[model samples]
Target: MCRWLAYSGTPVLLENILYRPRHSLIDQSLHAKMGVETTNGDGFGVGWYGTSGTAKDTPAVVREIGPAWSNRNLREIAGHVRSHLFFAHIRASTGSAVQQTNCHPFRHGRWMWMHNGAVADFQRVRRDLVLAVDPDLFLHVEGSTDSEVMFYLALTYGLADDPPGAVARMAGLVERVGHEHGIEYPLQMTVAVTDGLRLWSFRYSSQGASRSLFYSTRVETLRSLHPDLDFLREASDDTRLIVSEPLGDLPGVWNEVPESTYGVVQPEGDAMFSFAPALPA
Candidate 1:
């Protein structure tokens, strides 16, 4: 339903990750090779943490109800802003209105979240899902998209303290509610979330087949394989990118995230875990 990318590494201008790649997120907006739709022009957003002259914990976000490919504002921002961690998304409405509020990479405090799939029959169970959000956080639901609802649900379930557990609970609730509504295969998602210092990504769907998700091969390894590429040469060993699709065709530069799994990228190290929905208690 959508395409998204999350980058964490040496501080670099946004264009390096959002525009300069061979198959950038901007290119995916119009010619997505793996998304269900070829065009994700409904809307787009970019969220990044500021490194200097301002708060470093809370991110600055910009969104628009327009295609990223031709959005001069996005291009301009990409040219100048530098971040060590950031998220960018291009949307293809599964039915939601094409509005700025419905864009991906929704944010709250020091956290940001984005998704690439839909909640099956979302409109049928929207109220039930929305009601599950904490009343205090529910007030922040500015958009009517299922992705945004999913974010608040995770937050309500303790995403700040336990992201993986919180998300599993969120997905579990969606499936439980969907089944109660008589909908089968009630969830589909490849989600990314971060609190500036670390990022977590997951791929899962109730019916088994889920959206595409890939993580970049380590820069240290890629450098030994393709030292001629300046990008890898300049990148740090800890740099990481998790995306809905490979950004380029560089050999040994990407690996598919296994089915039913979640991962985290951080300075200490990175890891993958078997993931499953745990019915919320």
Candidate 2:
């Protein structure tokens, strides 16, 4: 339904990930290899943390209702802006209106969230899911897409306090409502979220199968594998990327996140853990 990528680590110009790689996010917007749809051209968005500003902890978001590859504004910004953590998404509307507000990498204060799949039969369960969002947060939701709704649901379930747990609760709630509507296996998603300092990504669905997700190999490992690559030698040890598909064909540079798993990336390193829905009472 969509494609997205999140970067955390050394501050680098956005163009490095959005446009420079062999199969960059811009390329994925037009030729996604792993997503259910090959092209995600309905809209695009980017959110990045500003290093020094009145809103340093918060992120600046730019969204447009156009293909990322052809958007001159996106190209110009990607070349100029730099951030240690950022989120990028290209959308293919499942059933929602195509508008800038509906673009992803949605922002809420200091958090940025994006998704690469859809809530199955979303319209059938939209009201219940939307009503579940806390009234305070619900007022901030500006889009009609299920992706934005899911983000607010996570925030309502405590994303600001515990990301993974909040997401599990959100997922559990969605599945509960979907089942009530007689739909089985009604969720599909690979989500990425960040709060300027740390990044969290998840891959899960009501069915055992889920969409593709991958993280870059350690910078050290890549340096050893491709000693001649200037970028590898220059990148920091903590540099990490979570993407819907591999950014390049480098044989040892990407590892698929296991089914039903989530990963946390910080300056310390990357950590993988099992993920499951924990419905809140």
Candidate 3:
């Protein structure tokens, strides 16, 4: 349904992640090899934590209702803005309107979220799912995409306090509603979320077969393996990326997120944990 990447570590120019990689998110927008679709050109967005200046606690976001590859504004911003953490997404609409608001990397305060999957038969269950969101949060749900709805659902379930648990409850709710509507495998997702300091990614589906999701190998490990690579040397030990597909074909540079698992990435290191939907009553 889309392609996305989340980066965390030493502050780097946004272009380094969005355009400078051998197979950057910009490249993926036009030539994605691993996503369900070969192109994700409907729209795109970038959300990043500013390292200096005012409002450092919240991220700054830019979204456009055009293809990332052709967006001059996107290129200019990527070349100038620097961030310690950021989320980027390019969308290929799955039955959703392709307006600017529908672009991903949705923002709320300091938190940013994006997804690369869809709710199976979303139209059939959209009403039920929308009603499930907390009324307080519902007004903030601006887009008509299942992905945005899912983000709000996670927030409604307590994302600000416990992200993993909140996401689990959100998934459980989607499956519950989907099943009630006679959908066998109601959810599909490969999600990335960040709250300025920490990044969390998840991969799971109702059928136990989710979409592709991967995380970069530790920078230190890659450094040792390829000491001659200047990029590796320039990057700090904590530099990491969670993406829908490997940015490049570099072997050992990326690891597949196991099915039904979530990962946490911080400056200390990375950790993976088993994930399952815990339906809320």
TM-score per candidate, chains pooled: 0.98, 0.97, 0.97
List candidate 3 segments past 4 Å from native: 52-56
**Per-residue error at 244 for model 3, in Å?**
0.5
TM-score, ranked from best to worst: 1, 2, 3
**Model 2 segments more than 4 A misplaced:** 52-56
Q: Tell me how far the alpha carbon of residue 125 in candidate 1 is from the true structure, in angstroms, after superposition.
A: 0.6
- The sequence of per-residue lDDT tens digits that candidate 2 reaches over residues 1-281 is 89888987778999988999999999998899988899999999999997653335899899999899899999999999998888999998998999989998899998889998889899999999999989998899998999999999999999989999999999999889999999998899999988788889999988989999999998998888989998777688988988899999988999999999998986576788999988877
Of the candidates numbered 1 and 3, which has the greater TM-score value? Answer: 1
lDDT (10s digit) by residue, model 1, range 1-281? 99999999888999988998999999999999999999999999999997742335898899999899999999899999999889999999999999989997899999999999999999999999999999999999998999999999999999999999999999999999999999999999999999988899999999989999999998889989998988777788999999999999988999999999999997689999999998888
The window of 10 residues in a row where model 3 has the poorest summed lDDT is 48-57
| lDDT value, candidate 3, whole model | 0.90
| lDDT tens digits by residue: candidate 3, 127-222 | 999999999889898989999999999999989999999999999999999999999999999999888888899999988889999998988899
Q: After superposition, how far is residue 121 of candidate 3 from its true place, in Å?
A: 1.3
Q: What is the lDDT of residue 269 in candidate 1?
A: 97
RMSD of candidate 2 to the truth, in angstroms, is 1.5
